[model samples]
Target: MLKLHDYWRSSAAYRVRIALNLKGLSYESHSHDLRSNAHHDPAYKALNPQGLVPALDIGGHVLTQSSAIMEWLEETCPEPPLLPPAAADRAAVRAMAALIACDIHPLNNLRVLRELKNDWQADETQTKMWAKGWIAEGFTALETLVGQHGKGYSFGSEPTLADCYLVPQVFSAQRFGVSLDPYPNIRAVNERCDDHPAFVRAHPRHQPDADTVDSNH
Candidate 1:
């Protein structure tokens, strides 16, 4: 069985969960409370030097990084493919995924928000505005891309790697009070994903360690 080092609200971990569910692969989840700094423990550090969530223990070998793990899943389990067959289409899907994974998510993750509040002495309002600003910027660009390429999902009628990345980011955006009204395409995709079994099963709220406490970013 695969072992997944996870945090219920980590969007990176959330992405991997979506991919794993989409691939119909089962994994054992080991919850690490990011708000409590459980990820910084030496044991987890040894497992993944970066001490990030969503590390996959595939038998004896381990895989870190949500994007890498999802790519590995796509390669290992090709059925119900997360990427398109055509190279150009695949590239487009990757670009959409990167818009959320790289451009948007990195800036608004828990660590960055914490840094803003703790290191820079930003109040709650300022931190929220910081997250909202980046999300709005990214969503502005992503809305155009999704409008151009999306049918029902982020790329085509079927869910793809783009959808896997998009859904979690939407969750994060909602958490930070970023409105989805400006991006109907993005909102529509999220609405479509809401009914998807894979997406529903992989939601952060459904994770083993989910709690009512407002500890997420």
Candidate 2:
């Protein structure tokens, strides 16, 4: 059986979960408690040298990186396709996905936030500000892209890879208090996709590891 090593709140891992559900593939989920530093354990490190939450063990062939995994799934499954048919359409979808994964998310990943607190002495407030700032910048560009080019969706009327990546990043933006008012297109696309069962099930609160979060929040 396929197994996914993941954290419930990690957006990167969330992307993979959505992709897996979209394919309608049954898989086991192995929770890694990020707050407890379980990702750094020697056993987990052996699986992912980067100590990241999303490491997919596909019948002994380990796959790292969420974007690559999503693309691989699209290629291998090829039903309910996550990409568009035209080359230009596919490129546009990929461009939107990269705006979040490469430009915005990398700067605000778990390790980066931890380093800011540990090495730079940034308080929680400051760290949160940093996260919001980058997300806003990225969203501004994406909003424009969607507003000008999007047709009821990020690329077109159908949900594609862009929608999969967009919804999760928006979820993180909301977590850090990034206002969604400025990105109507993104919010609209997110709202439409959120109604789908695959997306609903992929939400952080619904994951197997979700119970680990403190109830106080």
Residue 195 shift from truth in candidate 2, angstroms: 0.9
Minimum summed lDDT over a 10-residue window in model 1 is located at 208-217
TM-score of each: 0.97, 0.94
- Per-residue lDDT of 10-39 in model 2, one digit per residue for the tens? 889998888888889878999998878999
Regions more than 4 Å wrong, model 2? 212-217
What lDDT score goes with residue 121 in model 1? 100
Q: Kindly list the per-residue Cα lDDT of model 1 for residues 149-183, writing each as its tens digit.
A: 99999998999999999999999999888889889
Name every residue pair that clashes in candidate 2. none
The per-model lDDT (C-alpha) reads 0.92, 0.86
**Ten-residue region with minimum lDDT total, candidate 2:** 208-217
Score candidate 1 by lDDT: 0.92
Give the runs in model 1 whose Cα sits over 4 Å from its true position: 213-217
Cα error, candidate 2, residue 189 (Å): 1.0
